[model samples]
Target: MTLGEGTHTIIAVAMGVDGQEFPSAPVTFSVRLALPAPQITQPEAGSVQDMNLWIGGTGADYSAQVQLLEDFNHDDYGYSLVTLTGGWGRLFNLAPGVHSIVARQTINGRQGPVGIAHFFKVRPSRLTTVNVEILPSQEVKFSGTGHNGATVVLTYVSGPNNKPLPEVVVANGVWQISAPDWENGIYTYSAIQKVSDNAGGWIPSQDFQFSFPVSTKVPDPTNVRASADYSPIFSGNGVTGATVLIRKQDGTEAAPPAVVVNSFWSSQSRQEWGPTFDQIVQVKQRLDGQESEPGVGVVVRIAPLPPVISSLSDNELSPLIAGTCWSGAVVNLVFSDNPAVHTAAISGTEWQFRRRTEFAPGVPHTVSVTQTAAQQTSAPATRTFEIRRTLLKPVIIDPANGGEAERDLRVRGDRSVAGARMQLRVDGIDTGPATLTNGGLWYIELKGLAFGRRILDAQQTLDGRPSERSDPVVVNVVLMPPQFTTPQPGGDLPRTSTISGTGMPGARVDVWLEGRDDFLLRGYPVDSNGRWSSLVILPVGVKTLQARQAIEQVVSRDSPPLTFNVVPAAPYIETPVKDGHIGGSAVVSGFGVPGDTVSIYLGDTLLGGAPVLEDRTWSVPVTLTQPDGAHVLVAVASLDGFKSDRSAQQPVVLGRYEPSIDSPRAGSWVSHPVTFSGQGRLGTGQLVSWFNPELPWAPNLAVSAQGWHGLSVRALPAGGNWCRFQQTIVDGADASTISDWSESARFEVLDPASR
Candidate 1:
């Protein structure tokens, strides 16, 4: 409950704890109603109306004189006069534009804080008609016609707010305003005329609305073409300064951005690094830093180059051009003078065609050919040759003479006439017939040949007539490559381990380490039993190696890579050995490589590190943080950036014999399952002898690395009991060290029924 707004008397009373009552002095005061300030209510904010206006609202005091003011004045004739009536008042004929009404009341001859009403406006008698127009550039132009010589005001209306437009001019009943740039959105405009005589009078017209929008036209890329060299070029038309984005179907950018200049844009040529299948290309335009919708896409196919033509033979009667291309591609031969187009039969990526017409000797003819695959044509491959018949030597098409070839050989040669059957001989031994194909080319395939030098020759018989034997083509047959049988891929290997593999007998094997390309020619000779082994010094890191066989001057392909890791040798803590005793600060010794930094740990507590000496030994002295108890420790060694695994933990006693009951000290009592924990100079796996009449020592209750051990007990009499502990370290059949009996530590045993 709140007290009324007035001066009043307040009193208070209190009651004592013993029923005594106390009362405060009586405060006298007077009560009076607090009259509210005046407010204007008639004309709403931003409303367009005639010159006659009324501003009024509830709130004013009659008993203590209250008054209202518009624009901070109620006495001057230039301002609105607020006449008070009953608890409400009205200010008549208020000025135009924005105005605020405020009310103040005098109480006890003191003026109170004024209360203000919502802003209001008053318009003149005649309104001005407003017209709005939007230009091509999205510029807004506003015009109006009002009273002659009247100062017409134009305003931009957005939502419930009105802002006056600057630089508006009105002459001879005409007024206009223009904005060079405007944002895109729906807008409302209004015009007001001041009557040209009254400075404060303004007549507002009805709202005129208009909308300015951004351009939505997106240009499509045109004339997209791919050249022989795989360079793709395209052009398009769009708004000036608009950016064109070209991308492939895979969402990867195909070319750099191109800015439109004078409504035209041409993209720079983009080349594909290798063969590409048919893919759809898309393009979009961006204007004023805003991207438009993507345009229609264009599908384009990029052709790959055909196999190279290694050599060509010249013939007077019929010139034959043969080479290799992609399988299923149509091969076309084009001559400079002849309109007749020649085609070749594609057989397993090989194409051959005959010129048919005779060519003059010493005359060079420009010839070009193309290959078409999947309806896509390749760039023209051109060559120039002269016709001169003088030799009948057979030429090897593949695996040129003196080069290495596999055991299975395909002997190919060119014949001058059709219906010619050829015979092939390898090292003077008849191999097989060289069947003539429809393309006037002869070839023979031989398999199961021994690995060595192969001398090949071909003899052709035309119309049952045998021709002289051709020249011999010598080729070296290489053996099968070696395979890695040890240290499989991703396997772990020692730092200095042997790499062995199987290869041809007596064949020298060359080891190539990854990232060490300069060791290509280094060879390790293998034994004559077709087995090889080599000692390699690998660094402590991930290593990869491959091997190849090199017999005489020929080298086979490299074997698959073998990836492995070279790890550092692990170190172990030697001193303060497992189950041993240590007191105060003890030296921790470990074995590691020279210069290795060994980190020591005592049950997860780091004890710093020490560098190993040249004798492959390291020692670090550490203070035991635990008091007279067993503990476990480990050691790790790090050399360079390679670190070894943590060594096996060593459990040892950490302090001397200074034992005391850790819990339930002297004069305190404990319950059953009495875990009597106390520290002593006892080694792990050692027993503590308890001298107490209430309890007996058990042989199996040996002290662990943590020093504490538990024993379960049944109900015991509630009374004081004394206990003592003694520890000794004993080797097999011999006592090495013994600690004196610890000082007597006493505690009371509680009854199980009362616990």
Candidate 2:
């Protein structure tokens, strides 16, 4: 039992124990039961308000209920526990006052006070306001006062239908209410009230309104007109970017406007790339985002020209190497138009043919192959198959009667169109024609054709009647005028260099370093992008540079000259001493270039110091010393700042020495590895040593965690009880051992069955 405020006591009858036998004896002891220092743990409102109080502690008698008095300090302060059980109790719905929590326990007709009392403040009572966010058909989150056990009601009349908006009970303080999928509209909720407020009385607040968003899609295109374009005819394909105009009724092919789909605008015609035709092109076009009617064929697919080589793949007739004797070497003529090459002529000093592996004996040779690709186009690509061999031949040309022409457009034709000396000419330009190649075959090509019409020339000598030329074909030339676009302000040169431009590709585009020599660098042809890019190799002492592209004309602007220093390479030391000694903590430096990496080493051992600075300067203290004797210290530097260099060996005596193991509790089961560790500075040379026990007459033993490490080990044949371990350290020429043969720990390596 406990007193209302002071000390209290408990009484009981008990017995003393003697060999588990109880002796008849009654005893009464006062536990001095203080309600373990009272602490108002919860209700952390900082101050008490209305009516709320919580008192917690230990050591309270479960037999008695606690009593709390309000206004204990005479200043209208009060406290109480109408629902007290054990020592934990909470009081809520309190009045404004300074309150204290006091409890006392009484037992066996005795009583004492509770540990301590507490104070709190409670002002007045009112409702708390909250800004809740949500919509009738949408979900939102909320907490505290009006949550859970809360009855929320929302009222709203559906538009037109004159119905109510669908509502759902809230869960986890979140509710979902949505109207049918709609088009850009707002959901209005007139009134929303929380009937079951977690705090008490019902709370009716304002309603929420939410907006439903609508998305749009692309619309069908109309009134579409075609746009003109140009492209290079690749080796086996022709340009195909021609377009046609389209409209719902009567829109001219030349004039067209854009269309709109849900406020988004799109052009009338859109084009891309597609297949090729016979040395010609087929363009496909359509209104952007619009599908053409079936059978209308309104899309444009432009054909891009094959890659250009600019110049022959690296200058050299035959697989040129260092040697001079190229009697038999296969040489492929180079051209800006390669891979899909259309023509090759074999003649002159380059005639003999040899594979890459073959070495030339003495004479020179050349070999070429002509191939015709079968695809979207009917153009026949020709390559000369020749071998420039010093060895004479019957001049065995495929079509002996037909020889090669001076220009790149010569074609030795075959039947369907056969006849001797077939007159070869296109657009009125005569291409020297030859006879029917050996076997009733004729050869010819469109020679010197004026721009526009493309046609293969007839095969005929200047004297005879010219053979009729193939069907006249239409062709288009690519022209992308290289414009000097003011470059995006060039950042520091290193970031971006060598500019580019466009012009007649394959034409040697000269490059010049403005205000410098012209012969220095001739710019190369612009790449497919109508542009060129190359590194600006600055001369040794020159830190500034500028460049311009000579594509037809200088199309590059002056680049600002920026100054920056080149990072100089560091120096290093080589050659290390075999056996060296250096005082630990002494400045151990290496020999190397001033700006290189220099490292310190005690002979083969490295003291590993921080990298040396640019001045070839580096210093580190060598705190480690060794036993006195003939010892050498060395310093090695490295070429790369990272790697260490060779050594600068210095022979010197280290120190007088004495070293040995101290403690590990002789003959212990070796709980932790039997360590032979002891204190000692570096002598001339120190070596901590341990030995393995012998099994019978055998000397070899397997020690676990070997050398310098105090590791444990088992005898070869497993176990035989008595195990011995030892260690030793040597300094300079002095050596000693620490082992236990007289008193060694005996441990049994239990067998699986025993364990």
Candidate 3:
């Protein structure tokens, strides 16, 4: 049976072997074909587009095999196929050209007839460009065209920023939009066009990436000013309707932004002062709230009122000029006919300058003063004055009175009549006379005056007329002190040395050695020509010497103190006489120069050394651990790394230990308890004992490490009133190998109560 496109019901019966017919229940269902509506959604029918085309439509029931047919009904060549899971399908990559497209849907083994056919043309994109213009005012003009009258959208990117402009409809296949109030700089833009209505969304136009730059320079501010109260006003040129901003040198806006008009912008002067300072100010031009580069800067300085001249006067003696100016300005004073320019530093807004040179009497002078600050000089302020007459008196300018004077004494005085004759007197006797020069100075040299305090006076004479004598001056002349030529202060010298210096001729020079009680004087006669030399001996250790010279019964002051040391010539050995016994070390001592180090030697072996003290003495306990024999001991003094000759040799014996019992005589009385004391070489293991059987043996008294030992015994046997002590050398812990005991030292023990 063939099934039609409608609902149907049927039943069947099976014939039994007996030829009987049977009937069963029937089922009903509808038979419908899964046809699809294959209308193209993108690259709408008959629309211009690129070679990349999208063919898509609804599919047949549950599952269908969909294929795009090129040149439908004419061989029906398949261009693309897609397996549709539902009733929808799509295809891509259709050949470029005008073509009729048909989609077929097949389910199972049955294929449905092709759906409604769609037509389209596949070609390269013609939406190739979008042009944008950035005007000097920062306004942007954008335009673009796309094939098939596609819709276009404009967008630009600048400095990592992208912004989309208004969308426009294509008129005659072209679209344009104008954007205003953009910052001046380079910009890159892209035109996004929709060539057809498709689910693929907007596509960027090919070769349509374009860029434009705004080249307008930043507006510059000019004629910036500030009033005395610090109120500020500024103006500048900028794009019309742009906001002009004024800022201080610190980069903070000085006021709210102002709008530009007629290509010029200005801020109204406000009653309130802006940041008032003598500094540069900057302004920036902005378009549509976008800031541009900084413009040129203008300096604003609202200067204070001119400084006041409080005091300006001239005096003949100690001339002074003073005034006040701006707190930080320098005051310069220039005088007429004077090459010296005086400058005064500003202290708390006050300035002053003092002239060291005295102004001539009755002389007219003009002085001008000005202030300089911030590299700008003010107008000159002037003053005129004349020097008044001062007191006229001659002043002595030579050796001061009562002061030391040398030979060729220059007797000079000022305020004398020019070319006048001047007479000089010494000790009431006229020595010489001199004529004053044109500069009112008179001087004369006096010679051959006796050594002693002499009175000097001077008077000026003109045309045989004499003036009153000036005040007298007293001076002393004598021989200078003698100085040492060799051995300077603090120098080391030998005991005998010569001391010399130059002194007055035929004068008596005396040298003095500083002692604890007083300075000891040694008289020596000077040569005829003032040179003196003397030989003197200085004691060892630190000694001080001084010298002075007397001429014509006048003695000069003592010279400076010369302090020095006399190093020792040789070392001295005062202890350990010839053939003396030395246990371990011998005590060697003697006197030497101070600050010397004395080293003691036994034959060729150095024992020890000690530094010399301030009293010129040194002592050393030198070790003598040599073998048992006589040794020659000597000492050498060393000062400042230099060694003196060895002292006289002395003999000493070593390596002999003397052991003896010091307590209890040969026969003596003693208490009931007895004590034994002895001396022996230290570390020799010497032991002491008592050998009276009736008395208890005394405690062993071992020799001390420091050369002395003692022992006491109690509860001695009462019967034996006398006891004897004998010490012996022992070996090891036991009393074996003992040397012969010392001779007996006997003492008797007695009861204290019985006495």
Off by over 4 Å in 2: 1-28, 32-163, 168-178, 181-187, 190-207, 211-755
lDDT of 2 by residue, 20-131 (tens): 5444455444344343333344444344333333444445555543444342442322333322244445334554334454555444555455445555454322213323
Writing each residue's lDDT as its tens digit, candidate 1 over 1-755 gives 66786678878889999999798998988766555655555555555544444444555554445555554565432322222343443325544445565666665676656676456555443452456665423345677676455466655656333435674445876787776545445556555565322345444533333333333244344444443345666566666667888887787877778987876776755665344566677877777666666574765566867555655775655677789998778888788657677888778988887776776433356778888876677788888876542323345566576887766567777743444566788899888556654323557887756778889877765556677787788888877677676667777555566778887766787777799865533677766666877766677777788888877766788887788766555666767655566766678986777767898888788987999887567899887655455678888777667666678878776645444445447777677655666654344322233444325432233554456454543343467755555455432232334343454456777776665
lDDT (Cα) of model 1: 0.63
Instruction: Tell me how far the alpha carbon of residue 242 in candidate 1 is from the true structure, in angstroms, after superposition.
Output: 99
Best by lDDT: 1
lDDT of each: 0.63, 0.35, 0.62
Could you list the CA RMSD of all candidates, in the order they appear? 41.3, 41.1, 54.7
Give TM-scores for every candidate, taking all chains together and pairing residue i with residue i. Answer: 0.25, 0.17, 0.25
Which 10-residue window in model 1 sums to the lowest lDDT?
75-84
TM-score of structure candidate 3 = 0.25
lDDT score for candidate 2 against the true structure = 0.35
Candidate 3: misplaced stretches above 4 Å?
1-370, 375-424, 428-448, 459-468, 474-502, 505-508, 512-537, 544-546, 550-755
